[model samples]
Target: MDENSHPLVKAALIHAQFESIHPFSDGNGRLGRILIVLYFVQSKLISQPIFFVSEELERERLRYYDLLNGVRGDQPDWSSWVLFFLTACHRMADKISTKLDAADKLAMDGLRRCQTESEKKVWVYTFSDPHTTVKKVSTQLKIAPSTARSALNALATKGLLYSDKQTKRNKKYVNYDLLGVLT
Candidate 1:
C-alpha cells in the first residue's frame, strides 16, 4: 500500500487498508471517505477536494460494509470496491457540475443587475460569504455602517438576500439562495 503507485490503484488500496486498520475509535468511516477525497485531490484527479461520500455510502451501507469485510477476509473484492468508487465519483461529479452551472447563472444575472463597481464588489462579497451580518460586511469592506446597510437592503430588495429579524440592532442577514446552492 505504498502511495507512490498509480493514484487510482493507491486510492483503492489505501481506502481498503484504512478500513482494515479502523484506526479511530469513532469516525473511521468518515475518515476513510475523507481520505478518498484527499487522495483524489493529491493525485490531481479533482481540482478541489470537495467531493462528499456520506449519502452515497449510506445508500449502499450494507453492501459497502460487506465488501470491506470480504476484502479483509482475503477475498478478491477489489473490483466491486472499484466499481463502487466509480459510481460515487460519477454521482459527485454530477452534483458539483449542477451546482457550478447554477452559481454561474446566478453570477451572470447578478452582474447584469449590479451597475456600479462597488455594488458588484458587494454582490461578490455577499455571494462568497453568505449568512454574514451587515456589521461584519461593513468591517470587512471598511465601509460605513450606513453604506453597508444600504448595500444589504438593496440586495435584499432584489431578492438575492434574506434575513431573520433579530432583536439586536446589528441584525444578521442570510443569503438564502447561496445557502441553498451550498446544501
Candidate 2:
C-alpha cells in the first residue's frame, strides 16, 4: 500500500518492507531509521523534525532488526513496533531535555566569562552547533575572519571548546561537553 492512504499503517508496513527489500547495498538500516523520522514529520505527527532516536535503535540494534524481519515475515506484530517507537520518542525527549539543561548552564557560564558581545555571540552559536568552524561562524555572523578566530580562540582557551591540532590550516573546534550532554 502507498504511504498516503494510511500514513501510520503505511509507515510501519513500508518500514518493514524496506528492510526486507534492502534497496541500498549499504546504509539500509540507517535509511530505514531515517524513513521513520521522515514519516513522523510528513504525517504531522511532529511539528518539528527534531525527534531523532537513531541512537536508541542502534543501542537495541538486534531487537530492531528482528522486529522488522518478523513483521515482514507474516508474524506481523504492529503493536510491538508502535510501542518501541513510542518508547524511543520518550527516551529521545528526555535526552533533549537534559541537553537543554546542560546548554543553559553552558550559556550562563559563557555569559560570565565572555569579555565582549562578539565573544558571547560566538559562544552561543558554538554551543548550538558544536562542530562548526571559524569560517562558517564568520559567514554566519557577517564578521571578519580575524574577529571570528579571536572569539573562537578565546572560547577554546576558556575550555568551552577544544581545538584539534590537525595538520590542516583550518583546524576544527568542538564543544566536547555539549556532545557529552547529548550522548
Candidate 3:
C-alpha cells in the first residue's frame, strides 16, 4: 500500500504475493484478481469497478501461471510477471473499448431504422432487457400485444433483432446485433 510505483505494477506485485501465499483452499485465483480492482478503486485510479482483467489473464492461462510461478521461484523474476499483467490489462481495456463502440453504433443504427414509436420503444427496451417477448414488451410499454408483436417482427426483419423458432404460443425476440457486439 505504501509502494511508490505505478498502480499496475503495484497491483501485479500484490497479486503475485497473494498467489504465492495461497491463503485459501480454493478461490485464491479469483480473489487475487479481484484485489487488483479493489486496489485500483481505493487508490482512485478508476472511478468505477469496471476494469476487469480476469478475462485477459484467463485467455493466457498457461503463460499467466508460468509467470506467477516464475515470480515465486528460487530466483524471483518480478519483471516478467509485472509486464505480463500490464500487457493483459492493456489488451482487456482495448477489447472493452472496441466492443462498446461497436455496440453503440449498432444501437444508433437500429434506432434510425425503427419505423414507429412502438418499434423505437421496443428497441430501447432491449438495451436494458435483452430478452423480451411480445407480452413482456406489451406490458412494459403499455401497448397492445399485437402492436408489440408487430414492432418485434419489424425489428427482426431489420436484422436488429432475431426471433427464436419457438412455439407460436410464446415467441421470444432478442437484440442480436447489440448482443453480438457485447458477447
Candidate 4:
C-alpha cells in the first residue's frame, strides 16, 4: 500500500490479507496479529509495538473471528472487518493511555516517598525495570554497591519497594505498586 493511505486502513488490509493467506498450520492467527504491530513498526508509524491490540481482539474473540470470516466469504465484507480492526486499535490505544497515566501517578507517588537522591533514583529505576538488584541499580545509576543497597533497602523500608528476601547476595527488589499500574 502507498504511504498516502490512512495507517489504520493499511494495517486493517494487511491483517485481513495475512489472515486470509493462513500460511502456517498452527500459528497463522498469532503471526497475523503480530503482523499488525510489525507493519506499524515497518511503516515508521510507531517506535515500539507496545500497542497490545491482541488484548482487545481476544476480549472480543467471537466477533473478531466473525469479522475475519466475513472477509473470506464469497460476498466479502471488507468494510465491516476493517471497521472492527480499526475500532480494536482505538480501544487498545485508549487502554494503554490509561495505563500510562496510572504509571505516571504511581511514579510520582513513589518519588514522594524517597528520602534521599539515591533512593529517588532507585525508585525511578523501578518504573523502568520492576525486578532489580543492587548491582543493576549501581550499574544504571553509577552509584556504589553499598549506596545502591542502602537506597534499595530504604525504599523497602518506606513501603515503596519489596525485596525478594535473598539476604546474602543478588537479592531482588520489586515495586509492586508500580507493577500494578503497568500490568
Instruction: Point to the candidate with the largest lDDT.
Output: 3
TM-score of each: 0.82, 0.69, 0.77, 0.93
Cα RMSD for predicted model 3: 3.2
Best by TM-score: 4
35-80 in candidate 4: lDDT tens per residue?
A: 8888888888789988768789989999999998898858999889
lDDT of 3 by residue, 1-183 (tens): 457898888898899999999999999999998998999998898889878898899999999999999987589998899899999999988998999899788778889999899899999989877888998999988999999999999998888888865657788887767777788
What value of lDDT does candidate 4 attain over all alpha carbons?
0.88
lDDT tens digits, residue span 105-177, model 2: 9789878999988889998888768997889999998999889998988988888889975536787778888
User: Which ten contiguous residues of candidate 1 have the minimum total lDDT?
Assistant: 163-172
TM-score sort, best first: 4, 1, 3, 2
Q: Give the least accurate 10-residue stretch of model 2, judged by summed lDDT.
A: 1-10
Better of 2 and 4 by TM-score: 4
In terms of lDDT, which candidate is stronger, 2 or 4? 4
Model 3's number of clashes is 0
